[model samples]
Target chain A: MCDLVVTENGSVVGTEKGRIYVKLHDEELTTFPSESLESITLMSNSTVTTYLIKQCLTKNIPILYITQNGKYLGGYRGVTTNKTSLQRAQCELFNTEFSLNFAKKIVTSKIKNQISLLYRHKSCDDVSTDIESMNNLKKRILFCDSIDAVRGYEGRAAAVYFKGLSRLSGEFAFDCRSRRPPLDPFNSMLCFGYSILYNLFYSLIETKGLNPFFGFCHADGDGHASLASDLMEEWRPLIVDSSVLSLIRKKMILKEQFTKAEDGGVYLNKDAIKTFRAYIQNKLFQKNHTVESVEEKKSYFDFISHQVSTLIRAILQKDFSLFE
Target chain B: MCDLVVTENGSVVGTEKGRIYVKLHDEELTTFPSESLESITLMSNSTVTTYLIKQCLTKNIPILYITQNGKYLGGYRGVTTNKTSLQRAQCELFNTEFSLNFAKKIVTSKIKNQISLLYRHKSCDDVSTDIESMNNLKKRILFCDSIDAVRGYEGRAAAVYFKGLSRLSGEFAFDCRSRRPPLDPFNSMLCFGYSILYNLFYSLIETKGLNPFFGFCHADGDGHASLASDLMEEWRPLIVDSSVLSLIRKKMILKEQFTKAEDGGVYLNKDAIKTFRAYIQNKLFQKNHTVESVEEKKSYFDFISHQVSTLIRAILQKDFSLFE
Candidate 1:
């Protein structure tokens, strides 16, 4: 059984054993018998004596020390000369691969589609405005932009993109609403697309050996890092945004297939969702060849991220690219 | 034995019969006589025709419609309807209570002390810089004094706050490296503080009727609503932030107790975390009486979000508050 231990101050200590201790000023506290304590997070500030340290070392307990603000201080093992190299190596592999995959997906095809989808709904006049804002956003990110500028414009850009994407998707699914209605195609597509992106990012992040909580782009907190969101940004247009457009334009699915509910909301019918899933799977794994002679087959997602990483590496190395 | 229908597309379809004919574009799609169809999604679009619909309705076979994008179209036998209502009701109740609780926490606390704790750090100047950024961030949030401002800044402001928070947190955690030999007392305090806030927010959000995704301040997407992050913001100063300041100012958790890891990281032993967790719990749940006779007995977290929401509601209603 998975046992979750939520301490008094909201520090959740999950372990197989249900036992936990509350330490006082200088005492070693345990609420239960000396059972196996699999995972213990020290969110307390009691004085650490050598005896207490030795006891933990003898017990071989893995302890995570975190600040009150949720900053991970580090983990404690009884042994001083632990194999840190293995941990670092594992983390490096995970981070590098994850970053590479993310970049491959973003630079080539995904970013273009995401940007296009975001701008798809804007009036002809507003297209430039959207483009301009995006360009500015890109510039800020590329220049290792001022922490201030990056911080300042991030939320606004996110809002514009989110609202724009939602509106465009809604429009694409409008015709299908009254006639076929089962679920809101737009919302479903968004959710499905996000889910896929999230799973991919989550897997990659987990593989990297880094605590997802310790992230660069997003904040650190209970809900921050949002590795899924960070990775999804580049792919949103290509996968979700384009998928919606294709479904609408192809007329493979019709509006009559959707159904409206009592809640004044819409959903897709079961058949429709099945069809959509097939389409997306095909899209993700679709092969593409960049050069005529190379004869290389790569997922559109993979190709895009690879390009993005190259661009990112260039930017980091101070070699300028159009991505900036 | 429960047998699932296997389809070419890898979706599972269930049927009472041993086998069923699935309409496909090319050949008459047929499957072996099995307990059920493993992949029901591969069933041709024609399977959902009027005759099939009527038959399904009469037989009470659970029918689910999905879009090509894997959006849940409605399902038959009232499963979708019931589930949707239950989910919605749950969301609404959780949102209201969470909001009320959070708001109450902020109004009754020592505001400056709370803010300082969230922003303070002892290990590096980078942490201090992060703390300083909070003042500007607060100003940015407060400057959006009206609903219009809130809406205008909603996207960018939230993003900036998230970014600032992440950066600040990263710095305080010493760039995700191990802490130094002389463990930063402020670091442990903040970490413990954050854990508490995270747990509190997690609980409140669980109770709220809102889909943590459908957040007002943050945009919507896989990572956007980050309800946990949103909730943590309000109590950053008082719980985690303030605890750090107090710990350092009073030297509750000493620097010597923090040991260096083989990886050159710093961390407090388990004893420290336990001690701090208790201290935080006491402070958060501490009750005080005010002359106004309003029950000031709410948890610190409850007070934080309440104040933030009150500010938001006042802004929405166009009533001015000092937070501006």
Candidate 2:
């Protein structure tokens, strides 16, 4: 009930005998026993079955499917045990005036994180223009009228911040935000990191019986992943961006490790992918103090789940201030 | 369990008292007691809530969500009351040689029906070429090396058949099989009909504890709806295509009852959508003979559920010929 049993790297398979078996080609490697295993993240080309998957599903143990290069493809889980109280509150407050206000809170928090990041890097000589632009956007969100306006300010702030990121010197040069086959080495790393963050938020949101497409900050639509997208907004700069920028600044991702496609799309070569995966995995184990409740150090994994609980509490109480 | 308790064409609200209160803009119109309701299909903008939805989920009573325009959006259901015998068999049989045989069976049946439809319309004298094309495709499927090849034949056959359908009548024209904002009225009707059929299959598959995405004909990718799509193939001509063609032939859908968009796409006008919904609902209640078990007459709704049970039986026996 407390911890995830992560089995990453190499091919893994499932069994009829209620255990997870890992392998490298034809060689049997290890088995994960089914006990106190809250979830399993498959980071390799793994084989599994409906029977074992159902066994995990019924117990509400999520099976997260990730690519070898650490892109989150999808997740599987059971019908959540009903928390009628929070579910009712979520349905009631959703798409109302209260939901709109909560969305504002989320965007405000996101802009705050962006401004804080700039404030931290302000001492750098060439960052004044970027910091000033972000600061202006943050101030505008205070008088924002619509969800579109909030999103407008957030978008503007990202443009300013990424400009600053590109100005950083090293192998991890930031370009424009390009995905759907990331066009550069830095963007490829950022995309993978954001996928993991989004998937983490998805698991957390659904455990509380909140519909992932129903959200305060995102437009409701089929297949939107709105709630997870909403929850990861503030954390994007704090977690994914910081990690990405650090990797670039430290020369962890090298130019030679990127491949150029005929169509001009750039991808992380295999060795580069291996290095990036290791860095992300290491980040999962690293602890940091929460910006809001600053005391004990907490892993990124723990902090994300706690964020979902805070969201649930916010929906139920009609107060979103806990989000900051 | 034999009959659905439907409350349609009104503004309805859910209550904690285990009954649905029908309302029309703040005026309480009627109420329906929740007993003997096998499922609830919301066919309007009518609102319902967590309390009654939770009540239905716990009892394994599925709640089908449909838009006013008769698009089947999604469904909510409980953890299936597991039949471990069938569940275990389904997993074991999936993706095996026997499952491949089942995929072959589905394609064979689908192609056969396409040929039959062409034959039935042979009085027109111009459909001979389409019939010959479909017959060749059907033969090619018998020698298909992979599921992709089988799917390739299926795709080709649809192209030939839709070409035939477009040639039937001037007003009942079809250009291509356009879904995702179906660009013509015929396509709009076809897409709506297909959605209903797919949703029906989804409910049946889940009731047998077989995962909808795990199937013989599918790649088993995330969110494929493979089983639903798989099961509905054999019935498409017998159901949706037949109903759509009949509506056009009967002049039930008029050309004036369609709208032209700025992008030159055609959509069913509101009144036309209402008419289409009625025809689909009526078809659901119309009795039809089963292709395999030809004894008792059954409604389309009953037949779809029976097909799932037959699939469960096939998985257990490892004899996919029953799928025929």
Candidate 3:
């Protein structure tokens, strides 16, 4: 269940007889049995051997590629699952009445979480009106008949949520949401956190044997893992936004720790990225993150696994009530 | 379009500055530009760095894995394409009337090639009756309305073709086609060769952005690349069987170069596999193999590429007449 993060630059990672070893020059740095690994994250310039890749694929341990500056590149999701029945079920369920219900659930749950986050900062700012507006939109999503309608409600809620977030910011300058080249440090952090959450969902959804491209709420697009984008909506505010808030509110990241790129995009600097990653790891794994719908206390990792499992079971049983 | 095969036992392959380099214990073995490689085949025990893999994947160069004894164990087929329209076309055409016609064509083409190979050895043995029986089955396949019936005819033709192959074998003891634990060397060679052919088609099919699991002739089974298995049928006798026969006729492999395993399966020994691989490479790449249907003179490499292109075009166009 351990996520192995290899940040050692210029080192080679190899596997021999099922044991993974790291070496620099002619010196063996470290070795461990690969059976305990859940995922491998390469965060720096390092080399990985084919034998290790073979072992990872055999164990279904996804190898995630992330840049040293905290941007998430794509990952090798190992082999596509051989579970054709599950894949067929997923494809068949898309665009059905069942899918619309699931889409509404995702939107409502996401807005509900957004409202909760806004409520957390109630003492710091007057976010009650925005929260009320989002609550109304969340209710309206239940009556949505089409995928586009659900997305429309979700988009409206995002407008209120982002505005509410700007008011809650104690020191950071925040405005409307911007991306591609996020204008402010606040939006940059949000974009970076969202990318990480999206890729996390991507790996989990594929591991559950569902087609990531075939989604319920999101329209199908070429080269897009639409389903991952759909599923991560409910968790974005809870996992990513909360973590970003913690880092900002605790004054753990200073304003000087960000750089404006040539394209006018603000990005986290190298030292700040290290602090950000450490904080995220602590929040996702060490802290108590619970599923409010299930009323169970667990780590965020378990929470993500539960959501993926629930989606697959709902698809398998042809029922959306399980999602509710 | 060169396929790089790495056979060094303990060498490590890495890429830097767009150049691929192989090393062993700090001593550089070889270096080349990464852009020149079309595919990579790992034949012996070796380690490949992640950088090389990333480059290969970005370039769409499939990395194939083969055992020291020539068993084709899967490969890394890189990323699935972003071509949603092409994928949609493939899925929509599956199990349609078009698929039935396509399935029949695959069987007929396969049987035709099998009959051609048998004819090549006509002077070696009296295989006239087996050839005629296969010819009758081949013609009947075109009239098949269902995939099961086409497969039934294919099975009957295979019975005749394998018997014909046994009769044509000059020195190898091949009574019948035995697999799993092939009882004789000839059957073992056939099994090994077919595995390679199947994987080759698997990589090619995925490279074309088609789902390899959804197939035409073969029934979709869990975990099986049915489309690869179906498509390779047309090329099996032409590529695998003919190369195997040439190995036997030219006395390239000796009888003593085969070992009987503890499970009663006869397999090519270490040295025999090398000779067999070299001969197959020569026949596939160096020989002027002509496509009789198009009256085109090309290498077996181009022949395989042409077949894959034909199948993809047929799937995209929704017209099996193109295959004809």
Candidate 4:
């Protein structure tokens, strides 16, 4: 019921007598009962046996891959989630007014989460203008006639929000949000954590029997998990951004642990990657009270799962109200 | 340039200093240069490192997994082949008159291949009646207006084809074509070889950026690579059946190498699996003169790749004439 993160470069993973075991340089590092594993994340250059692949597929545990710099490199899927009806419904929803509305709801919630994070750090940094801008942008989403307009507002709000976060970074300089190869440590950690969160959302969406390529918010395109990307948008500030900010404020991941490439792209080293992965896993599994259900504390995993379930229901019933 | 078949149980595969290495129980068994690998196939309980997976992905080498009994469990894909226009065209061709015509061509070609195989073994077995029936079925396919009718004719043709194959089996028992758990040794080898061939087609179909699920010849369903199945139909007799027949006739795989389960299902054991895998690999890569271009020799792999490319052209142009 937990994520097994294997970050060692030369480690080999395989199953032995129904138990999953990890080895590094021929020495057995550890073994876990298959039941204890919810999913597995392999970072850098670790190896896995076909036996482990088979066991993961049989147990429905996804095996995700991340590059050394923390870019999500997809994963080995078991039997594809194959609900034709759900996919049909999802495809039908695309390019409709309902899709536009759904996109607006997602964008607004994302902005709201960004505003909430900014307000929480208001005492430490003057984020009043960013918060106000985000709030106004959230309202403007209601008037968005197209997905492009919603995307435009979301992009503008992200710019204002990231600028506020830069002020909150203190010692860690974050001039602007940079991806591919993050320009700064903060951006590096943010991109890394976002990649993890994106994969998490991707797995959950596929598990819910929804086509990951079709989406209401993100436009359908080749080679992109549009639906998963769409779902991750709302949770970016709530999960990844929050986890990254906590790591920076707690000094858990130092800037020295990150190395700059010749092209000036920052990347977390092996040990720092381990720390970041552990922190993200803890953040995902930790339970916290929500604004709507203050009496019931829910883990980030539970919240994301609930959102996916609600999205499926919305698609099936042609009703976005319950999801919103 | 050839497939790296990893059949050793407990063997760990990884890359060390840019060379792909296999270690068993920490003993260095062998290594290969990345450029020397075309694809990878893992059988039984072998292990592979994430580094190898990354290497394979980066090199665009596909890793296929097959169970001990030779059932294809699937493989780890790198970046998905993403030509949106190709996929769109493929989906649009489904359930159309073109689809029906295209399906007829596939079925006819399949039946013709069956007849050709029967004729090749005519001197050894009395397959005249079966060959005649297949010819009639192939002709019937041309008049068929529906895919189901084409499938019906195809099934009947396969029934006749397998019967003739059984007559040609000599010492091996092949009462009928039994799958899931093949009922006899010949059926076991046939199924195993077909599984490999099916996966080969599946990978090629995806690499061409055509939707493997939306197939003109086969009805789409849950968890099935219908397009792969559709394309594999024509190649079954040409590749798998031909290989299995040669193996049986040549005694390349002995009958004792097969084992029967408690429920009376037959499967190839570990050693026989190696022999079968090697034979199939040889058969796929072996170049020989073909009927269409008798002066020029083409490998089976070339034939399959050409078929896939032709299929793409057919879909794009909305024309099946060139493909047929």
* Interface RMSD per candidate: 26.5, 19.9, 3.2, 2.5
Error of 3 at A80 (Å): 7.3
lDDT of 3 by residue, A1-324 (tens): 566667777788777776777787758887788676777777776777766666666567777766654455555544445556676677777679988988888888889999999998799888888988898998888888898988898899999899888888767859799998788888888888887777778777767777677788788776677888888888889878888888889998888989998998899987787777777767677637555666757887777787788877888898887763
The TM-scores, one per candidate, come to 0.31, 0.50, 0.92, 0.90
DockQ, each predicted model = 0.01, 0.02, 0.40, 0.41
What is candidate 1's DockQ?
0.01
Off by over 4 Å in 1: A1-113, A117-126, A140-148, A151-154, A158-184, A208-213, A221-225, A258-266, A289-294, A304-324, B1-324
Per-residue lDDT of model 4, residues B43-134, tens digit only:
75777766677766655577777677766666666556656556656666668888888888788888888899999989997889888878
Q: Kindly list the per-residue Cα lDDT of model 1 for residues B155-182, writing each as its tens digit.
A: 3433433344334443243322112232
lDDT of 3 by residue, B201-276 (tens): 7777777777777677677676677888888888888888998898888888878888998999889987777777
List the candidate 3 regions with Cα displacement exceeding 4 Å.
A15-33, A69-80, A287-296, B16-19, B24-32, B69-80, B287-297
> How many clashes in each candidate?
119, 0, 0, 8
Using lDDT as the yardstick, the better of models 2 and 3 is: 3
Q: Is the docking of candidate 2 incorrect, acceptable, medium or high quality?
A: incorrect
lDDT of 2 by residue, A1-324 (tens): 323323444353455365556566767776656674566666543444434454565566666655544555445544334353454456556556776677677777887786676667666537877777787887888787777888888888888788777666354666688987788887877887788777777766766666555567786543446678888888877777777766666777778887877777677777766666567756765775556657778787677776787777777787767643
How far off is residue B255 in model 1, in Å?
Answer: 52
